[model samples]
Target: MLFFTVFELVAALPYSYSEDLARTVAQLGALAHCSPEVISAWSCPLCKKLPLTNPQPFGLPDFNLSGYTGTMGTRLFLLFRGTEPESVINWIEDLTFEMVAYPHCEGCRVHAGFFASFKALRGQYFDRVQQAVSAGKEVVVGGRSMGAALAVFAVLDLARTFPEHVRVSYNMGCPRLGNQQFADWASKQLQIYRLVHWNDIVPHLPPRTLNYRHISREVFYDEPMANFSLCNDSG
Candidate 1:
Protein backbone atom coordinates (compact mmCIF):
# COMPACT_ATOMS: atom_id res chain seq x y z
CA MET A 1 0.00 0.00 0.00
CA LEU A 2 1.20 3.50 -0.76
CA PHE A 3 1.80 5.69 2.29
CA PHE A 4 1.13 9.43 2.43
CA THR A 5 2.52 11.71 5.12
CA VAL A 6 0.92 15.06 6.01
CA PHE A 7 3.39 16.84 3.74
CA GLU A 8 2.30 14.94 0.65
CA LEU A 9 -1.36 14.75 1.69
CA VAL A 10 -2.14 18.40 2.28
CA ALA A 11 -0.95 21.80 1.17
CA ALA A 12 1.34 23.78 3.40
CA LEU A 13 -0.68 25.85 5.84
CA PRO A 14 0.26 28.47 8.40
CA TYR A 15 0.63 26.63 11.73
CA SER A 16 1.66 27.98 15.10
CA TYR A 17 2.10 26.09 18.36
CA SER A 18 1.02 27.68 21.62
CA GLU A 19 2.66 26.64 24.87
CA ASP A 20 -0.17 27.93 27.07
CA LEU A 21 -2.85 26.08 25.15
CA ALA A 22 -0.77 22.93 25.19
CA ARG A 23 -0.25 23.18 28.96
CA THR A 24 -3.96 23.79 29.59
CA VAL A 25 -5.05 20.91 27.39
CA ALA A 26 -2.40 18.67 28.93
CA GLN A 27 -3.97 19.44 32.32
CA LEU A 28 -7.38 18.60 30.90
CA GLY A 29 -6.03 15.32 29.52
CA ALA A 30 -4.75 14.42 33.00
CA LEU A 31 -8.07 15.41 34.52
CA ALA A 32 -9.81 12.92 32.22
CA HIS A 33 -8.40 10.12 34.36
CA CYS A 34 -10.21 11.49 37.37
CA SER A 35 -13.56 10.36 38.72
CA PRO A 36 -16.88 11.93 37.74
CA GLU A 37 -17.15 13.76 41.05
CA VAL A 38 -13.69 15.24 40.71
CA ILE A 39 -14.35 16.24 37.12
CA SER A 40 -17.67 17.81 37.95
CA ALA A 41 -16.12 19.73 40.81
CA TRP A 42 -13.17 20.90 38.69
CA SER A 43 -10.86 20.09 41.59
CA CYS A 44 -7.50 20.27 39.81
CA PRO A 45 -5.20 23.25 40.36
CA LEU A 46 -5.49 24.52 36.77
CA CYS A 47 -9.20 23.75 36.74
CA LYS A 48 -9.64 25.98 39.78
CA LYS A 49 -8.55 29.03 37.79
CA LEU A 50 -9.91 28.34 34.31
CA PRO A 51 -13.47 29.31 33.46
CA LEU A 52 -14.28 25.69 32.77
CA THR A 53 -18.02 25.01 33.13
CA ASN A 54 -20.56 22.26 32.56
CA PRO A 55 -18.04 19.48 33.13
CA GLN A 56 -19.46 15.99 32.51
CA PRO A 57 -17.79 12.57 32.36
CA PHE A 58 -18.82 9.85 29.90
CA GLY A 59 -17.65 6.29 29.30
CA LEU A 60 -18.45 2.64 28.63
CA PRO A 61 -18.71 0.54 31.75
CA ASP A 62 -17.66 -2.70 30.10
CA PHE A 63 -14.48 -1.29 28.61
CA ASN A 64 -13.74 1.14 31.44
CA LEU A 65 -13.07 3.82 28.77
CA SER A 66 -13.91 7.26 30.13
CA GLY A 67 -13.42 11.00 29.58
CA TYR A 68 -14.82 14.44 30.40
CA THR A 69 -16.23 17.28 28.30
CA GLY A 70 -16.73 20.90 29.22
CA THR A 71 -16.61 24.45 27.93
CA MET A 72 -13.70 26.78 28.60
CA GLY A 73 -14.94 30.24 27.71
CA THR A 74 -15.93 29.98 24.04
CA ARG A 75 -14.07 26.73 23.45
CA LEU A 76 -15.83 23.41 23.77
CA PHE A 77 -13.35 20.86 25.15
CA LEU A 78 -13.49 17.07 25.09
CA LEU A 79 -10.78 15.08 26.85
CA PHE A 80 -10.26 11.28 27.03
CA ARG A 81 -8.07 9.31 29.46
CA GLY A 82 -5.44 6.77 28.46
CA THR A 83 -5.41 3.05 29.14
CA GLU A 84 -6.00 2.01 32.74
CA PRO A 85 -2.79 0.12 33.47
CA GLU A 86 -4.53 -2.21 35.91
CA SER A 87 -7.64 -2.84 33.82
CA VAL A 88 -7.31 -6.04 31.89
CA ILE A 89 -10.07 -4.91 29.54
CA ASN A 90 -8.27 -1.68 28.64
CA TRP A 91 -5.06 -3.55 27.90
CA ILE A 92 -7.01 -5.99 25.76
CA GLU A 93 -8.55 -3.12 23.84
CA ASP A 94 -5.18 -1.45 23.39
CA LEU A 95 -3.65 -4.65 22.08
CA THR A 96 -6.45 -5.23 19.57
CA PHE A 97 -4.91 -3.38 16.62
CA GLU A 98 -6.89 -4.69 13.70
CA MET A 99 -7.56 -1.91 11.20
CA VAL A 100 -11.12 -1.21 10.10
CA ALA A 101 -12.84 1.25 7.80
CA TYR A 102 -13.68 4.56 9.45
CA PRO A 103 -17.34 5.10 8.45
CA HIS A 104 -17.17 8.90 8.48
CA CYS A 105 -14.66 9.10 5.63
CA GLU A 106 -14.03 7.17 2.45
CA GLY A 107 -10.85 5.12 2.10
CA CYS A 108 -10.03 5.90 5.72
CA ARG A 109 -9.39 3.19 8.27
CA VAL A 110 -8.46 3.33 11.95
CA HIS A 111 -7.41 1.03 14.78
CA ALA A 112 -10.35 -1.24 15.50
CA GLY A 113 -9.89 -0.97 19.24
CA PHE A 114 -9.87 2.81 19.33
CA PHE A 115 -12.82 3.06 16.94
CA ALA A 116 -14.80 0.60 19.06
CA SER A 117 -14.05 2.58 22.20
CA PHE A 118 -15.11 5.83 20.53
CA LYS A 119 -18.33 4.40 19.08
CA ALA A 120 -19.36 3.03 22.47
CA LEU A 121 -19.69 6.44 24.14
CA ARG A 122 -19.80 8.79 21.15
CA GLY A 123 -23.47 9.57 21.62
CA GLN A 124 -23.04 10.54 25.25
CA TYR A 125 -20.79 13.51 24.48
CA PHE A 126 -21.35 14.23 20.76
CA ASP A 127 -24.65 15.97 21.30
CA ARG A 128 -23.17 18.18 24.00
CA VAL A 129 -20.35 19.14 21.64
CA GLN A 130 -22.86 19.84 18.88
CA GLN A 131 -24.88 22.05 21.20
CA ALA A 132 -21.79 24.03 22.02
CA VAL A 133 -21.01 24.39 18.33
CA SER A 134 -24.54 25.58 17.63
CA ALA A 135 -23.81 28.35 20.11
CA GLY A 136 -20.72 29.31 18.05
CA LYS A 137 -18.11 27.76 20.31
CA GLU A 138 -14.74 26.58 18.99
CA VAL A 139 -13.94 22.93 19.64
CA VAL A 140 -10.83 21.60 21.40
CA VAL A 141 -10.39 17.83 21.75
CA GLY A 142 -7.54 16.09 23.57
CA GLY A 143 -6.35 12.84 25.18
CA ARG A 144 -3.27 10.87 26.22
CA SER A 145 -2.06 7.46 25.09
CA MET A 146 -5.07 5.37 24.08
CA GLY A 147 -7.31 8.28 24.82
CA ALA A 148 -5.27 10.35 22.38
CA ALA A 149 -6.05 7.80 19.74
CA LEU A 150 -9.71 8.21 20.57
CA ALA A 151 -9.38 11.98 20.37
CA VAL A 152 -8.22 11.57 16.76
CA PHE A 153 -11.52 9.89 15.96
CA ALA A 154 -13.57 12.46 17.90
CA VAL A 155 -11.93 15.47 16.28
CA LEU A 156 -12.30 14.03 12.80
CA ASP A 157 -15.99 13.32 13.41
CA LEU A 158 -16.54 16.80 14.80
CA ALA A 159 -14.69 18.34 11.86
CA ARG A 160 -16.96 16.49 9.47
CA THR A 161 -20.02 17.98 11.11
CA PHE A 162 -18.78 21.51 11.73
CA PRO A 163 -15.64 21.93 9.71
CA GLU A 164 -14.86 25.52 10.60
CA HIS A 165 -15.82 25.23 14.24
CA VAL A 166 -13.48 22.38 15.13
CA ARG A 167 -10.37 24.35 15.92
CA VAL A 168 -7.54 22.26 17.37
CA SER A 169 -6.67 18.98 19.06
CA TYR A 170 -3.93 18.32 21.64
CA ASN A 171 -2.76 14.72 21.88
CA MET A 172 0.11 13.93 24.24
CA GLY A 173 1.90 10.60 23.93
CA CYS A 174 -0.56 9.53 21.23
CA PRO A 175 -0.03 6.46 19.12
CA ARG A 176 -0.67 6.19 15.42
CA LEU A 177 -4.43 5.93 14.98
CA GLY A 178 -5.09 5.06 11.33
CA ASN A 179 -3.82 4.12 7.89
CA GLN A 180 -2.22 6.48 5.36
CA GLN A 181 -5.62 7.40 3.96
CA PHE A 182 -7.04 8.20 7.35
CA ALA A 183 -3.96 10.19 8.39
CA ASP A 184 -4.03 12.10 5.12
CA TRP A 185 -7.75 12.75 5.46
CA ALA A 186 -7.34 13.90 9.08
CA SER A 187 -4.46 16.27 8.30
CA LYS A 188 -6.69 18.29 6.00
CA GLN A 189 -9.47 18.43 8.56
CA LEU A 190 -7.93 20.35 11.45
CA GLN A 191 -4.85 21.25 13.47
CA ILE A 192 -3.60 18.08 15.23
CA TYR A 193 -0.67 18.46 17.65
CA ARG A 194 0.77 15.05 18.45
CA LEU A 195 2.97 15.69 21.52
CA VAL A 196 5.59 13.04 22.16
CA HIS A 197 7.52 13.14 25.42
CA TRP A 198 11.04 11.68 25.63
CA ASN A 199 11.38 7.94 25.13
CA ASP A 200 7.66 7.15 25.27
CA ILE A 201 7.35 3.77 23.61
CA VAL A 202 3.56 3.87 23.36
CA PRO A 203 3.64 6.10 20.25
CA HIS A 204 5.42 3.41 18.26
CA LEU A 205 2.92 0.67 18.94
CA PRO A 206 0.97 -1.49 16.39
CA PRO A 207 4.02 -0.91 14.15
CA ARG A 208 4.20 1.17 10.98
CA THR A 209 4.93 -2.04 9.09
CA LEU A 210 1.29 -2.91 9.74
CA ASN A 211 0.35 0.15 7.60
CA TYR A 212 -0.69 2.25 10.60
CA ARG A 213 0.46 5.91 10.36
CA HIS A 214 0.25 8.97 12.61
CA ILE A 215 -1.32 12.32 11.69
CA SER A 216 0.51 15.61 11.20
CA ARG A 217 2.39 18.23 13.28
CA GLU A 218 4.37 16.14 15.74
CA VAL A 219 5.74 18.04 18.78
CA PHE A 220 8.58 15.92 20.10
CA TYR A 221 10.34 16.54 23.43
CA ASP A 222 13.89 15.27 23.84
CA GLU A 223 14.33 15.76 27.60
CA PRO A 224 11.95 14.50 30.23
CA MET A 225 10.10 17.79 30.93
CA ALA A 226 12.09 20.56 29.30
CA ASN A 227 12.56 21.46 25.62
CA PHE A 228 10.77 20.22 22.50
CA SER A 229 11.01 20.33 18.71
CA LEU A 230 8.26 20.48 16.09
CA CYS A 231 8.96 17.62 13.72
CA ASN A 232 8.18 17.35 10.02
CA ASP A 233 5.53 14.98 8.71
CA SER A 234 7.87 12.93 6.52
CA GLY A 235 7.56 9.69 8.41
Candidate 2:
Protein backbone atom coordinates (compact mmCIF):
# COMPACT_ATOMS: atom_id res chain seq x y z
CA MET A 1 0.00 0.00 0.00
CA LEU A 2 2.16 2.82 -1.18
CA PHE A 3 0.98 6.31 -0.20
CA PHE A 4 -0.17 6.90 -3.70
CA THR A 5 -1.83 3.53 -3.54
CA VAL A 6 -3.86 4.51 -0.51
CA PHE A 7 -4.29 8.05 -1.75
CA GLU A 8 -5.72 6.76 -5.02
CA LEU A 9 -8.10 4.53 -3.10
CA VAL A 10 -9.28 7.49 -1.05
CA ALA A 11 -9.33 10.41 -3.45
CA ALA A 12 -7.51 11.67 -6.52
CA LEU A 13 -5.76 14.13 -4.12
CA PRO A 14 -5.86 17.48 -5.83
CA TYR A 15 -2.33 18.93 -5.93
CA SER A 16 1.05 17.30 -6.38
CA TYR A 17 1.20 16.55 -2.65
CA SER A 18 3.16 19.15 -0.67
CA GLU A 19 4.07 19.76 3.00
CA ASP A 20 1.64 18.07 5.40
CA LEU A 21 0.25 15.94 2.62
CA ALA A 22 3.72 14.62 1.96
CA ARG A 23 4.07 13.54 5.58
CA THR A 24 0.71 11.81 5.53
CA VAL A 25 1.70 10.00 2.36
CA ALA A 26 5.00 8.94 3.90
CA GLN A 27 3.28 7.41 6.92
CA LEU A 28 1.01 5.41 4.67
CA GLY A 29 3.89 4.55 2.39
CA ALA A 30 5.75 3.10 5.35
CA LEU A 31 2.75 1.03 6.26
CA ALA A 32 2.25 -0.16 2.70
CA HIS A 33 5.90 -0.82 2.08
CA CYS A 34 6.15 -2.71 5.34
CA SER A 35 3.52 -5.21 4.40
CA PRO A 36 0.50 -5.94 2.28
CA GLU A 37 -2.58 -5.53 4.42
CA VAL A 38 -4.73 -8.58 4.00
CA ILE A 39 -7.57 -6.12 3.95
CA SER A 40 -8.06 -2.39 4.57
CA ALA A 41 -8.43 -1.63 8.25
CA TRP A 42 -7.68 0.93 10.95
CA SER A 43 -4.67 0.00 12.99
CA CYS A 44 -1.66 1.55 14.61
CA PRO A 45 1.76 0.60 13.27
CA LEU A 46 3.02 1.53 16.70
CA CYS A 47 0.25 -0.49 18.29
CA LYS A 48 2.75 -1.72 20.88
CA LYS A 49 3.57 1.88 21.77
CA LEU A 50 7.09 3.24 22.06
CA PRO A 51 6.42 4.28 25.69
CA LEU A 52 8.65 7.30 25.16
CA THR A 53 8.55 10.39 27.35
CA ASN A 54 8.98 14.02 26.44
CA PRO A 55 12.61 14.93 25.73
CA GLN A 56 13.60 11.46 26.83
CA PRO A 57 15.93 10.96 23.86
CA PHE A 58 14.83 7.45 23.04
CA GLY A 59 14.79 5.86 19.57
CA LEU A 60 11.72 4.03 18.37
CA PRO A 61 12.15 0.46 19.62
CA ASP A 62 10.60 -1.72 16.91
CA PHE A 63 11.22 0.61 13.98
CA ASN A 64 14.15 -1.42 12.71
CA LEU A 65 13.13 -4.18 10.29
CA SER A 66 9.85 -4.98 11.99
CA GLY A 67 8.76 -6.30 8.59
CA TYR A 68 9.22 -3.14 6.51
CA THR A 69 9.96 -3.23 2.82
CA GLY A 70 13.51 -2.52 1.69
CA THR A 71 16.68 -4.39 0.87
CA MET A 72 18.25 -3.63 4.23
CA GLY A 73 19.85 -0.22 4.43
CA THR A 74 21.23 1.30 7.60
CA ARG A 75 18.37 3.18 9.20
CA LEU A 76 18.84 6.40 11.11
CA PHE A 77 15.90 8.41 12.37
CA LEU A 78 15.43 11.34 14.74
CA LEU A 79 12.18 11.78 16.68
CA PHE A 80 11.88 14.24 19.55
CA ARG A 81 8.66 15.95 20.44
CA GLY A 82 7.91 18.91 22.66
CA THR A 83 6.95 18.55 26.34
CA GLU A 84 3.85 16.45 26.52
CA PRO A 85 5.41 13.37 28.13
CA GLU A 86 5.91 15.02 31.54
CA SER A 87 9.67 14.29 31.48
CA VAL A 88 11.32 16.70 29.08
CA ILE A 89 14.80 17.42 30.32
CA ASN A 90 16.56 15.96 27.29
CA TRP A 91 14.60 18.21 24.93
CA ILE A 92 15.49 21.16 27.12
CA GLU A 93 19.18 20.33 26.80
CA ASP A 94 19.07 19.82 23.02
CA LEU A 95 17.41 23.19 22.59
CA THR A 96 19.74 24.82 25.11
CA PHE A 97 22.69 23.60 23.10
CA GLU A 98 21.28 24.89 19.82
CA MET A 99 19.79 28.16 21.01
CA VAL A 100 21.73 29.33 24.09
CA ALA A 101 25.23 28.04 23.38
CA TYR A 102 25.23 28.35 19.60
CA PRO A 103 25.84 31.54 17.70
CA HIS A 104 23.58 34.44 18.74
CA CYS A 105 22.16 34.79 15.23
CA GLU A 106 19.71 32.73 13.12
CA GLY A 107 17.06 32.39 15.78
CA CYS A 108 13.58 33.55 14.74
CA ARG A 109 11.13 34.83 17.28
CA VAL A 110 7.46 33.97 17.38
CA HIS A 111 7.20 35.84 20.66
CA ALA A 112 8.73 34.35 23.83
CA GLY A 113 10.85 32.12 21.57
CA PHE A 114 13.38 34.96 21.45
CA PHE A 115 13.96 34.51 25.16
CA ALA A 116 16.42 31.83 23.96
CA SER A 117 19.14 31.94 21.33
CA PHE A 118 18.82 29.21 18.68
CA LYS A 119 21.75 29.66 16.39
CA ALA A 120 22.87 26.92 14.02
CA LEU A 121 20.61 24.57 15.95
CA ARG A 122 18.67 24.34 12.76
CA GLY A 123 21.79 23.46 10.78
CA GLN A 124 22.94 21.04 13.45
CA TYR A 125 19.85 18.92 13.09
CA PHE A 126 20.23 19.20 9.37
CA ASP A 127 23.77 17.90 9.67
CA ARG A 128 22.58 14.96 11.75
CA VAL A 129 20.06 14.05 9.06
CA GLN A 130 22.69 14.55 6.43
CA GLN A 131 25.06 12.21 8.21
CA ALA A 132 22.48 9.49 8.14
CA VAL A 133 21.91 10.05 4.48
CA SER A 134 25.62 9.97 3.69
CA ALA A 135 25.84 6.64 5.43
CA GLY A 136 23.18 5.35 3.01
CA LYS A 137 20.52 5.23 5.68
CA GLU A 138 16.84 5.79 5.15
CA VAL A 139 15.97 8.58 7.52
CA VAL A 140 12.45 9.16 8.77
CA VAL A 141 11.24 11.53 11.47
CA GLY A 142 8.02 11.48 13.53
CA GLY A 143 6.61 13.41 16.47
CA ARG A 144 3.19 13.69 18.08
CA SER A 145 1.90 17.22 17.68
CA MET A 146 4.50 19.60 19.07
CA GLY A 147 7.18 17.20 17.97
CA ALA A 148 5.55 17.30 14.55
CA ALA A 149 6.53 20.96 14.26
CA LEU A 150 10.17 20.02 14.82
CA ALA A 151 9.77 17.17 12.36
CA VAL A 152 8.68 19.71 9.78
CA PHE A 153 11.66 21.89 10.64
CA ALA A 154 13.93 18.88 10.30
CA VAL A 155 12.81 18.47 6.68
CA LEU A 156 13.36 22.11 5.91
CA ASP A 157 16.74 22.06 7.61
CA LEU A 158 17.79 18.89 5.82
CA ALA A 159 16.65 20.23 2.49
CA ARG A 160 18.94 23.20 2.99
CA THR A 161 21.91 20.99 3.75
CA PHE A 162 21.47 17.56 2.19
CA PRO A 163 19.01 18.35 -0.56
CA GLU A 164 18.71 14.88 -2.04
CA HIS A 165 18.78 13.03 1.25
CA VAL A 166 15.39 14.25 2.42
CA ARG A 167 13.40 11.99 0.14
CA VAL A 168 10.38 12.04 2.47
CA SER A 169 9.36 13.55 5.82
CA TYR A 170 6.32 13.28 8.08
CA ASN A 171 4.68 15.07 11.04
CA MET A 172 1.41 14.30 12.82
CA GLY A 173 -0.78 17.16 14.03
CA CYS A 174 1.98 19.75 14.14
CA PRO A 175 1.62 23.33 15.27
CA ARG A 176 2.66 26.25 13.15
CA LEU A 177 6.26 27.35 13.78
CA GLY A 178 8.47 30.28 12.89
CA ASN A 179 6.61 33.12 11.16
CA GLN A 180 4.86 33.81 7.91
CA GLN A 181 8.30 34.42 6.49
CA PHE A 182 9.50 31.08 7.79
CA ALA A 183 6.48 29.15 6.58
CA ASP A 184 6.42 30.89 3.22
CA TRP A 185 10.13 30.34 2.87
CA ALA A 186 9.86 26.68 3.88
CA SER A 187 6.85 25.98 1.70
CA LYS A 188 9.22 26.38 -1.20
CA GLN A 189 12.39 25.09 0.44
CA LEU A 190 11.54 21.50 1.31
CA GLN A 191 9.25 18.58 0.54
CA ILE A 192 7.81 18.89 4.02
CA TYR A 193 4.61 17.05 4.93
CA ARG A 194 2.02 17.35 7.70
CA LEU A 195 -1.00 15.33 8.90
CA VAL A 196 -3.88 16.76 10.89
CA HIS A 197 -6.94 14.72 11.74
CA TRP A 198 -10.25 16.58 11.68
CA ASN A 199 -10.35 18.86 14.75
CA ASP A 200 -7.71 17.13 16.80
CA ILE A 201 -6.03 20.48 16.62
CA VAL A 202 -3.11 19.71 18.89
CA PRO A 203 -1.05 21.70 16.43
CA HIS A 204 -3.15 24.67 17.42
CA LEU A 205 -3.04 28.48 17.62
CA PRO A 206 -1.73 29.61 14.31
CA PRO A 207 -2.12 33.09 12.76
CA ARG A 208 -1.35 34.91 16.00
CA THR A 209 -3.28 37.82 14.57
CA LEU A 210 -7.04 37.88 14.22
CA ASN A 211 -6.43 37.86 10.48
CA TYR A 212 -5.92 34.25 9.50
CA ARG A 213 -3.55 33.36 6.72
CA HIS A 214 -5.54 30.51 5.32
CA ILE A 215 -3.40 27.37 5.07
CA SER A 216 -4.77 25.87 1.89
CA ARG A 217 -2.05 23.24 1.85
CA GLU A 218 -2.41 21.97 5.39
CA VAL A 219 -3.53 18.29 5.14
CA PHE A 220 -6.52 17.34 7.20
CA TYR A 221 -8.26 13.98 7.07
CA ASP A 222 -11.19 14.16 4.71
CA GLU A 223 -13.89 14.02 7.33
CA PRO A 224 -16.83 16.08 8.56
CA MET A 225 -14.82 17.64 11.36
CA ALA A 226 -11.99 18.45 9.01
CA ASN A 227 -14.43 19.92 6.52
CA PHE A 228 -15.97 22.04 9.27
CA SER A 229 -12.58 23.21 10.48
CA LEU A 230 -11.66 24.11 6.94
CA CYS A 231 -14.99 25.88 6.48
CA ASN A 232 -17.04 27.65 9.18
CA ASP A 233 -14.28 26.90 11.71
CA SER A 234 -12.82 29.94 9.94
CA GLY A 235 -9.35 30.47 11.27
For TM-score, the strongest prediction is 1
Least accurate 10 contiguous residues by lDDT in model 1: 1-10
lDDT of each: 0.79, 0.40
- Candidate 2 lands at a TM-score of 0.51
lDDT of 1 by residue, 136-182 (tens): 99989998888888898888888888888886888887888889988
TM-score of 1: 0.87
The reply for model 1, stretches above 4 Å from the true place, is 1-15, 44-46, 85-94
In terms of lDDT, the best-performing candidate is 1
Q: Report per-prediction Cα RMSD to one decimal.
A: 6.0, 10.2
Candidate 1 local Cα displacement, residue 104, angstroms: 4.0
Show where candidate 2 strays beyond 4 Å: 1-5, 9-75, 82-128, 210-216, 222-235
